[model samples]
Target: SDYSQEPPRHPSLLINSKVPFNAEPPRSALASSYVTPVDLFYKRNHGPIPVVDDIERYCVDICSLIGTPKKLYMRDVRMLPKYNVTATLQCAGNRRTAMSKTRKVRGVGWDVSAIGNAVWGGAKLADVLELIGIPKLTCSTQSGGKHVEFVSIDKCKEENGGPYKASIRLSQATNPEADVLLAYEMNGKPLNRDHGYPLRVIVPGVIGARSVKWLDSINIIAEECQGFFMQKDYKMFPPSVDWDNINWSTRRPQMDFPVQSVICSLEDVQSIKPGKVTISGYAVSGGGRGIERVDVSIDGGKTWLEASRSQKTGVPYIADHVSSDKWAWVLFEVTVDIPYSTEIVAKAVDSAANVQPENVQDIWNLRGILNTSWHRVQVRVGQ
Candidate 1:
């Protein structure tokens, strides 16, 4: 099975990159619900999708930097209990288009569609570690600082890179509260080819890069993952640092993202019916802090209307996430009159009260990783 072959994709997805296939659903299609449909979910592949037909040979080697290693087969992982987690996986570059407006930036110019929520089903990462007999934490001097490094099977083009990789604090990985999983299913269906068919890590509440697709192996390290994606990329740099004087090694990889929201119902310079119109979009925050409120202003922030939120309710497979601290995205709506052409604005606050920055220049960085600026769109009153 050649990994270079292109897989079938949903016709509705707006293609971004072709060879390595990156795409996202249209803005209107995303407002449909809290859980994005698997077919319509945004696909962000950095390299060729490895052909994975040989399930019997598909094994994940669990090695350690400071302890004994182990190899686990797919049979061993599947034998464990399955847990369904309703969580949102958002790319770090989800709103790069907005950031580009401030200044030119490098990397993929993704719009708002790079973020989506889905019900992921797999064995809890904590349970998997316990089954593998990872050493328990103790206050003794023998305690090795734990970092769970996930290595992806796909080859990437990053500097000093062979494969896409990432890692999170082992304490966070083993903590039941983190809700991490080696997810084999998305939206109740086996993962599609574009979404890591055989296996992928689902690191709820963090940037999408942390959830390595097409997972190949795991390693427990004493320090953070030294992979390219972990160190040189997916990090933010101050606006002052231009490409000529940029140092990729200076910054740390982004973990929990800042509060962010996007206006999905309307695009820039889109025409709309006269009088009152409904404005809708999706809002989400990282690190499981959850969204607090989304407010929309049609007249450049003079007056505001609170948007009604629609989060997932009573999905039998997912429990307790329906609350505020839930890890899923919240679809919001509000109606405002558009008597004449004017600027439409929206900003959201996460549960931690971190409000979305209104000005992109204030938060502008070199890579444009976290662009949570007040999402603005131009609407003209017309038929």
Candidate 2:
């Protein structure tokens, strides 16, 4: 693969892999702000980045199983009303390294920084589909199309060097409330090449894998795309299944992630002053579910205290608030008196009352995806 065309990245990012360019910001960087800066956002790539020199000529083809296919230029998509959707995208492999410690797991090794929230500016996909005659909230087309597949220009070994692709149900794609976007801008500025430059699909509240970058085309099909990431990869499996006996088809591609929380203010193991220590981190849930609560335990889950949650500075975060950004994450913090060496843990509950599993051992899978177990860190107090 040609690495010459890859764009420059932030030096502060901790590089997990250099070839395909996967890295994430430091844990402290994540807790420092609400909307993560674009450069600080985690980078996960399966293949070498694709370069698009002619933005004017770059177009995304929209094809249906039975209707005439249409190619939409940037100008054509831009004509629709622009909506800024704030959403969090997390890799399914986030915290895979921790899972690996429990048992050897396959995939990129990531800490808790594998997630980030940003404001995406783009044309609503629902509105864009209407231009092609697909009505809002459409579940099926006259041609029996039930899924919307997004194909990318970036190719990877997973697909035998073919462009990366994934799909979402057509019903979700057409729901205006889903906030799906063909985003061209991130954080109020034009998207950098590291992200999908000219355009990319942002499937809010879903795992980032389905949100394909570097737009190429869209397909309306009767079934989900049989892409490698969609079928053989990104599925949840039982701990009993190993590579030899594993059956990929037995499981479904994971969409909305489970409730998760992480303590970013401290590392996995750190020494700190013995007085009052401030604990800070992020808590988020998938499928537009709001974070109902974040619990922090200083003595290793023996007892817990509720942490204050907020999305914007000075504003209290209320779960499922009518005015809250349902697709974004909430920041939680609590200052506790730590007089001795102890273990700290954080866990979250979603609006639906879904709580994170207590242990990673229970949720461990061969692929190490969706390790939404309670986050724990050991800390030593200085005399």
TM-score of each: 0.93, 0.99
lDDT (C-alpha, whole model) for all candidates = 0.82, 0.93
- Over the stretch 1-383, how does candidate 1's per-residue lDDT look in tens digits? 23457688899898888866889999889987777898899999888888889989898888854446777778888898898998889999988877887798877878889988899988878787776565333111135757888998887777333788999988887887788899999989988778887899999889999999888898877788998888878888888887799898888889887888888889887898788788999888888877778899999878888887777455321213444437877788898778888899988887778898878998888888888889999988876
Residue pairs clashing, model 1: none
lDDT (tens digit, per residue) of candidate 2 on 226-311: 99999999999999998999999899899998899999999979999898999999999999999999999999999999999999
Indicate the residue-level lDDT of 348 in model 2: 96
Candidate 2, residue 222: CA error in Å? 0.7
